[model samples]
Target: MDTQKIPSPTLTLPKSLTGIQGLDEITGGGIPKGRPTLVCGSAGCGKTLFAMEFLVHGAMLYDEPGVFFAFEETEKDLAINVVSLGYDLDKLVAEKKIVLDHIHIERKEIEETGEYDLEGLFIRLNYAIDSIGAKRVVLDTIETLFSGLPNPLILRSELRRLFRWLKEKGVTAIVTGERGEGTLTRQGLEEYVSDCVIVLDHRVTEQSSTRRLRIVKYRGSTHGTNEYPFIIEENGFSVLPITSIGLDHTVLSERISSGIPRLDTMLDNKGYYRGSIVLVSGTAGVGKSSLAACFSDAACARGEQVLYFALEESPQQIMRNMRSIGIDLDQWEKRGLLMFHAKRPTFYGLESYLTAMHKAVNDFKPRVVVIDPLSSFIIGTNQFEAKSMIMRMVDFLKINPITVFMTHLTTGVNDFTGIDISSLIDTWLLLRDIEIGGERNRGMYILKSRGMAHSNQIREFRLTEHGVELLDVYVGPEGVLTGSSRITKEAQEKAGQLLRSQEIENKQLALERKRKAINAQIDFLKAEFDAEEVETLNDIELNKLRENLLLQDRIDMARNRKGDIITNKNSINKARGNIAKS
Candidate 1:
């Protein structure tokens, strides 16, 4: 029976994470799995490091063993060089997590002959992958084979076949190449590994060096179209993600104290919103640093971890200065609630600064982070670039509920803040130096606060031993009260109030005395009138009794007379009647 012709099954494209966060971000997920990606760059662009990190990350982060075929550097040389990055190649090799093969091909030893294929190279790679069960492979700078072999026609044909075979083997691979004149790789190696391509670039402008990584082409994958900066630090590599924008970060409605109770009140809020960015801006010696210290002290008092980034002053110097203001940051440091990271801005590039900051924050894991005077962060960078860096940093920190305070030193009279990151800030506190009577006074007020009520009136603030004291807005004839004028005016007003109070008391005393005298006079007049009334009444009663006696005596006399007359008449009549009776 004839063998049935078998058709191959359809293959789905798989993605393998390179374990580099920024790289993974740029590539969307990672390089296409079981396929080769071309990485081309000129000298010292970290082309080799990129490939090595891919393998190392695969082994460490993904638990996927990798095979590295280095065409330029020997295994011993590679192991020694990567030691600084904290990658131990020897250990990984011993653990059977990786296999390192350094293939040396010299033009002097090889003579190009006819009908030759790269089957030997394929055999070596197959055996290594099978032995270690590597799911990832890196043929570093495979374009070097062009220099070793003279026949271009045969070399090109074999190179195409090699990429195909690697893809067929079902292992993710990184093939590094040197940059060419117009094409991607020096040997025009972009044709074979056309699925995904990355270009590394190193350039110096204005005496500052920056390394940028860009994805030239990702055939079937959506990726970030911007160039991202990467740095190699002590711990490992880090990518300053240029794409930190979105609502993807976690938001919080909760608030935290500004470390200054009065300042918190001025925020017109519960406090600064958790995971919000705060900017304190002022001229020189306007208590910007003092305010930052207060905030740090406040956070420490709450038993919250704080990361203090002192870009200008030494840690001890800052501690000593804050101590004078009654803010004991050293105590917090001792208690392990506060950590101080001090460095000079002039000694490092922007990338290095961000890398250091990122590492410090990750390691420390503080709820509050302070960059004392972010003005120095723009020392060597332009305003736009510095603000961009700050924006990215803010996005990074705001993902958690970590509050950030960055102080900016104002320059001119017009510029309230030296930089214009106000648009990105959640709460902006502006400090002004008011010149009066040949003295500089610090006035503070809130310029803006998102999602909260804030006081607009400027307040005269003083830095005392107890920290920042935001005094009441003294509204006087000239304006708000401040300094000696406020004190003098208050004293004068108090004196006037005392004088008015004394005058009122004297008038009340005089009125009370006059009232008492009048009352005494009224009592005497009433007694005099009562005596007169009693005397008049007695006289009238006596007159009435006398009249009654006289009238009764007269009446008795008249009755007696009348009775005598009647008797006389009766006697005469009686005589006449006696004669008639007889």
Candidate 2:
């Protein structure tokens, strides 16, 4: 009869501003409620963006008003900077959902007194918050205070006071600071804002710039410690948190055709999986774009919207080229099933491109996306950054369950130059121009198709007025043809052999039909001769009849035998040739 005492349960928490996509899972809902978060970073590390996004999202998504105080940029510049990200700061200000206050603290414009404190900042922030009833506050680049006030001791004390004041105000705040060499910030602000610390980094690896965000420490809460990759897109920043989802898990059982029946056959009796990433890698002038367009046209024909991002070629150029290949992309575009985004890889930073891509995905909500020649993006970035960008892109695509087609340019027949993106793809199709004998020919082969059995043989491909046609599998002494030389020789041999066989078969079938008709005429002549009156036949008539019947029988038998022999010989030769080649 002893009763056990029940322990009190921990209180469940509310949602917080994750500052990233898919980051709330790691933080158990968000940062602690109503406390300041410190975001410290070097130049161009996106600390300002992180803090701005938090406030913007809070105002827009959670129905909480926010206040943004900038010490460096003017309110106009901040509004313009976030405009591309789909944040209408002007409208938000009008609606009283958010307030932006820019404090111009120019050292040359004003002289600081000895008893100067952040009283003005406190007053401005207090007025903005009370005016808008803001639940979130952000001070972008609070380090600008140091630029105006040269004394570090006073700045540190002021920072501590600012944190305490923000807590007293009970508004969750983000204070951004510049990173120092050894310390977190040049003014040691990290010590003052000890509740939460986040570090943003922008580094160049292998000539590519990558942005990463890390949680240095979160007081009274658990947070992810690893540096998560993030991209600044039109809709704001998208942080990529690497989860442990297994790659081998079964995808959707549905299949989609590659637009070419022959190519589909090469894949399998079925086709590519619904949500698979297809990589088409080959040398220059190998028609990767045409292949991608063909696939796109097929999808469009099936009523699926496609988003095609051409990094190297303009949309008009792609449309003209595809038209030359007999693919009418213009019609699809007019029908609103195909959208093209053509831009230079170096037009903006990698994060900007990522952001643009993100915006396109959200706006279009396409079923399939194609990025022509992913290698072009590798020019400004190092190998590691390129790899990371590609990985994040793939992960984002996977989450959306959208089919992606990427093309890469290789250097040689078997040599992959620059960054190798094959590892991130689910299916790899290698197209090459093989040289055989004295002519050049095109060949295509599927190097690998994960989770499916595909043809291992290299098949010849040809571009015609109708479209791309896949020729028979290349069977030669040097195995399959690869370059232009090999392809030419294989094509010539195959064409000759096919023509010769068809000629012989045609001759045999024609002879067989002629022989059967002759046999019928001979039988009829014999019957007439046998049925004629036996007593009164003239010698010339009988002799003529017998001679005609004999001639017809002889012709029929010889022709039929010739047809059979020719047919058998052709079949045997073809079998022997195949065996010999094998």
Candidate 3:
């Protein structure tokens, strides 16, 4: 079989970067280049701002001149609105890099009786494009242009023509539209554009509003289909793509201190892995925030930047409170090594908070971030949302390789689940109150720490004037002891030990006395034996003298008898023998 080897079309599509943080990443490098993209949303959903940002980003960042045809606002209104974002529109205008045209349509003047043609509109748009040699265009809205014309057939035709003309003009464009009932746009502009369609939504749940963006459709391109949370502030628009960050982030082996040396000792003699998520969870007044402050202090002391997001307390209040623990957070703040963003959790939605954190991190480029009491995010929502937000947050920070130290205040004294985000944490430090001897004491232990051998012993720590001092909890026959009980037990043991030492000393002295008495008895026995030996020698000498005297007397008697018996020697010997025989 003969197979024809046909060349495959380029898998990648030409794209224009939006220059908006996280927006370009989700849209796969912005919307399709040189094509019309529809941005539709309800009122106050930032549809117009989205489109304007596209144009402004195009002009300023890409060096591509742009034309913005506004149907709702004038040039002055648009410029004033965007000026807060630090965009000098008038300067761009004077430079002939941008062209702003406002199309005014009074609905009261037109009737629904005739065909609507956009030839005149086309001429003005073409002139604007030609004037600036624009490569990007933004139509503030599609509804305003067709508001006077009620015929759907004519609206569809003109919408298609508008999109076609923009495509032929070879300028990447964004057309803003009001959301319709169950439709993406009021006039079904998504059908005409066909290239790209983005939907912005401002939804309020539980009295909290969050602005979100989702790519509805993109022809011939893959994009992030999930709804991405976005924010608009003085700095400008930002989109937070949750799934855009994956688990492929680079990991680090470096470790940073938690500021408490004992706590670090509990964690494998190292504090925490760099670019890892650490969660400190505890009950109320269990010193969760204090531990977080210690981490921040340690990081700042190391000359690393820390972004502390305080949800409950103000920066001044936190600094003041931390001062009692001998931690001067204000010094780090003044030195510009630490930055605090204190805001109430209810001030905005979770997504807004996420976006704010994202912006703060991006702007500050912090090496470490501290979110004290992450449980506060669950004020109005459930744990699911908070966990999702935290997951996204962890993913973002992990990718940046920033070490995150978070504090979570548990609801119950024994409850360890703080928004149920334990699985996302790499190191979890659990603190609780240990009640003993009618007194409560603080104890901390590592619940889990990945990639290291951590201590399982619960260390009772006190928040004294010198900071967190971890104490050794006594474990004995009375179970674990802390507070006064531990102190009392230690004192009793010390007294017993002292008494035992005294008793041992007395026994050693008694043994020494016995040893000395035995030595004296041995000395006395040796002296008695020496005296008996001298007496025995004297008795033997006396017996020898007596025997010698008796022998002399017998010799003298024998000599007298022998003198009468014999005269010659031979005869005396013979006579002595005969007398002996007789």
In the order shown, the candidates' Cα RMSDs to the true structure are 11.8, 19.9, 9.7
Winner on lDDT between 1 and 2 is 1
User: Ten-residue segment with the worst summed lDDT in candidate 3?
Assistant: 573-582
> How many pairs of residues collide in each model?
1, 19, 0
* Superposed Cα deviation of residue 120, candidate 2 (Å): 8.1
Cα lDDT of model 1 by residue, 55-92, tens digit? 99999989999999999999999999899888999999
Using lDDT as the yardstick, the better of models 1 and 3 is: 3
Candidate 2 to truth, TM? 0.67
After the best TM-score superposition of candidate 3, give how far the Cα of residue 408 lies from its true spot, in angstroms. Answer: 1.3
lDDT leaderboard ranking: 3, 1, 2
Instruction: Write one digit per residue (lDDT tens) for candidate 2, span 1-582.
Output: 545754333544343665557556556566666888888999888887888888888888888899999988889999998887778999999999999989886678876567667787788889999998999999988888878876778777878888899989988888899999899998788878888888888887654567888889887666788887777765567666655223544478788999888899888867788889998888999889888998899999999999999999888999988888788899999999999998866786676787778778889999899999888777644565567677777777776888999898887888474676666778889998877566677789898899888998787887776778887755667676544555577678889999999999999999999999999999999888786755346665677667656655654675676766465666555544644543
Task: Output the number of the TM-score-best candidate.
Answer: 1
lDDT of 2: 0.80
Error of 3 at 266 (Å): 2.9
| 180: Cα error in model 3, Å | 1.6
Residue 562 lDDT in candidate 2: 74
Largest lDDT belongs to which candidate? Answer: 3
